[model samples]
Target: MIAIYPGSFDPITLGHIDIIERGAKLFDRVIVAVLSNPSKKPLFTVDKRIEQITECTQHIANVKVDSFVGLTVEYAKLHHAGVLLRGLRVLSDFEKELQMAHTNKTLNHDIETVFLATTKEYSFLSSSIVKEIAQFGGTIDHLVSENVAQDMYSKYQNQ
Candidate 1:
């Protein structure tokens, strides 16, 4: 079945990649849909975020990268995706994700929300954490892909 893995993916952390890779294996197609939110100032533009996700997920044959600018359920419907795939790292994530799933269900009863438990190693990894480390000149090579690390470094170097 087609599943949409929707997120801001500001820089596509390894945690995100882990979810995408695993989701790709479970679904016939896993679209890594980037949410285009103008209100939040993201380090990378929507186009750049899409490119980063594409680069990181290139090895996963069933993964596709795209951007959307509306409710995630709407995006899933527009793309004919039957599932909304999400990753759960901890109880806090569960609380928030569960709420979103319920909200999406209310918006579209036909679509299902599937949650995957994150790998132990990446339980604490997140895009915000990765960006925080890079912003402080800390090593983020272990938190994200090499390409993403370089991109983060390049973006922060000018600041």
Candidate 2:
């Protein structure tokens, strides 16, 4: 029942929302886990990303958004989640996800990773791309939730 949807979610885009909505429909509970990594230059902080995801998914009864700062498998274990959910927008995501799935399986044999194909409409929408558009004063209203778009615009302006 409880499935963990883990991702950096630097800026939760429409693609992420699509995956969460689709995954939530199948699981009793869906945890939208925001991953934290200090190495990469992220546009938004973990707290901000969590707030965006929480705002976007608040209407979904079974979805909960939270942030994690360690191994995904460890987070899943602590959260009592037995399933790991992923979104595959294209074939390019396969190799990395496969490796991660195997590693997670090695860490927790009982936990499984389920990959869901993103809807065609959202297949081209990535958080990075949305951030680029937002940073350049381009409208990303359709690429993310209304709240996310507004937050991105405000954040970019303040920068």
Top candidate, metric lDDT: 1
RMSD of 1: 0.6
Q: What 10-residue stretch in candidate 1 is worst by lDDT?
A: 9-18
Output the lDDT of residue 137, model 1.
Answer: 96
- Model 2 over residues 49-123: C-alpha lDDT tens digits? 888899899989999998888899899999899999999988888888999999989999989999999999988
TM-score of 1: 0.98
Tens-place lDDT digits, model 1, residues 1-159: 999999998888888998998898899999999999989999999999888889898899999899989899999999999999999999999999999999989999999999999999999988898889999999999999999899999999999
TM-scores vs. true structure, each candidate = 0.98, 0.96
Residue-level error in angstroms, candidate 2, position 80? 1.4
> What are the lDDT scores of the predictions, listed in order?
0.93, 0.90
* Runs in model 1 lying further than 4 Å from the true structure: none
